[model samples]
Target: MLYFEDLTPGRRFETASHTLTQDEIISFARQFDPQPFHTDPEAAKTSVFDGLAASGWHTSSLTMRLITASELKNVANGLIGMGIKDMRWPQPTRVGDTLRATIEVLAQKASGSKPGFGVVQLRWTTLNQHDEIAMQLETSIWVARRPTEQA
Candidate 1:
């Protein structure tokens, strides 16, 4: 199982590849984000995005799946997401585009009072098959450390 010690600063972790499908994008958007650029291709084309796109939340969900598949479930601290910073949906992700992501360990430190736990900060970016960045976000997770008694 992963613990706070496993997240060394500067270390990088990657997510396995997955493809974005048209139907998946439409279905996800229809249920949650219903934006013109996400639900219909034609409407998307004229809607400033130039083509059908996945919702930003959908991209985030894909990131979650990738992270889970990458063995990150080891720590599963039920991550208390404090909040995200400077979140921007740069380029739109199109259907049939495959994506993968990398998470860089930006920082890790002890919690103010939670003696048995710490926090890890990371910034991740998802890239399409063409190596184009489709989404990026900063995040943090609370992690329990190996008991000091064990150390």
Candidate 2:
């Protein structure tokens, strides 16, 4: 598992891609979002998206899934998030769009109150097959510090 000491600023990790299918987008929207543009293809044709679009939340959820399934998830057995900041969805994710995610370490600092742990600042970027950014966010994660070894 990666400890706080191992995560340096500018370090980057990327995950395998997942294609967003119409069925998947519709199903997710039906359950959680239910916006016509996200749930009904015919209705979406006239929406600003001009086609069925995946909900921003669905895109975020898929990004989380990709990150957790990647090797980077080995950090401290799991990434313990402190909070998210500056989340933006710049473009609509459409059906059959293959999505990939990248995580970049922005900074790290020892926790003032939680000794043996640190808060790591990270930037997450999600892009579609055309390399268009679909979503981006900054977040802080609590990472365990390396344990002191016996002398």
Candidate 3:
């Protein structure tokens, strides 16, 4: 299991790709963000996206899934989010788009008050098959520190 001491600034990780399909996009949008552009392909043709688009929330969810199920899952403790900042969905996620994510450890610092944990700042970039950024965000996570061995 990876501990806080194992992480450093500039560390990077990549996740496997997942192809978004029309059915899943429509289903997810129907349940959560039922915008016409996301749920109806016909209506979407006239929308700003010009095609069916996945919800930003859906893209975020997929990003989380890729991260958790990737190499980052080796952390001593499961990924526990502390906070998020500067989240942006720059481009629409269209149907049949293959999505992948890359994570960069932007910074890390031991917690002053919480002795057994540290805060890690990470930047997640989710890109489509065309290498266009579909969504991106910076998040802080709590990582467990390595236990000190007694002499």
Candidate 4:
């Protein structure tokens, strides 16, 4: 089980890969984003992207899924997200792109108000098959600390 004490600055973890399919991309965009560049390939050809692209939100959702499946599933007490910062989609996620995620612990501090928990800041980067970064974000989460043994 992962705990506050186990997460150190510069620690890194990688997630399994997920390949984007055109049907899934269109389905996701049609429901959530509904933007031409994300949903309509022909329209996207005229847009800045020049081709269908997955919505940024879709990419973030995929990243979350990968993180949960690969890393958080084993963590004891689970994690509570505090907040996200500096989220950016540096490159478009297009159909047939295989993506994976990596996370690095940036900093951490024991919570003063909640002695049994700590706040950890992490930098998350999602990369495509070619190792090009697709999305990046920084977020903080509350992690439980190991219980202290009574004297």
Q: Flag clash pairs in model 3.
A: none
Per-residue alpha-carbon lDDT of model 1 for 82-111, expressed as tens digits?
A: 678877678888899898988888899988
Please give, for residues 59-100, the per-residue lDDT of candidate 2 as tens digits.
999999999998777898479888999999999999999999
Instruction: Report lDDT (CA) for all predictions.
Output: 0.85, 0.95, 0.95, 0.93
Number of clashes recorded per candidate: 0, 0, 0, 0
Candidate RMSDs in order: 1.7, 0.8, 0.9, 1.0
Off by over 4 Å in 2: none
Candidate 4 overall lDDT versus native? 0.93
Ten contiguous residues with the weakest lDDT in model 4: 71-80
Q: Cα lDDT of model 3 overall? A: 0.95
The better candidate by TM-score, 1 or 4, is 4
TM-score of every candidate = 0.92, 0.97, 0.97, 0.97
Candidate 4: residue 44 lDDT (0-100)? 96
Model 1: CA > 4 A from native: 76-78
What are the per-residue Cα lDDT tens digits for candidate 4 across 38-144? Answer: 99999999999989999999999999999998876666677678899999999899999999999999999999999999998999999999999999999999999
Candidate 1 overall lDDT versus native: 0.85
Residue 23, candidate 4: alpha-carbon lDDT: 96
| lDDT per residue as tens, model 3, 1-151 | 8889888999999999999999999999999999999999999999999888999999999999999899999999889999999999999998899999999999999999999999999999999999999999999999999999999
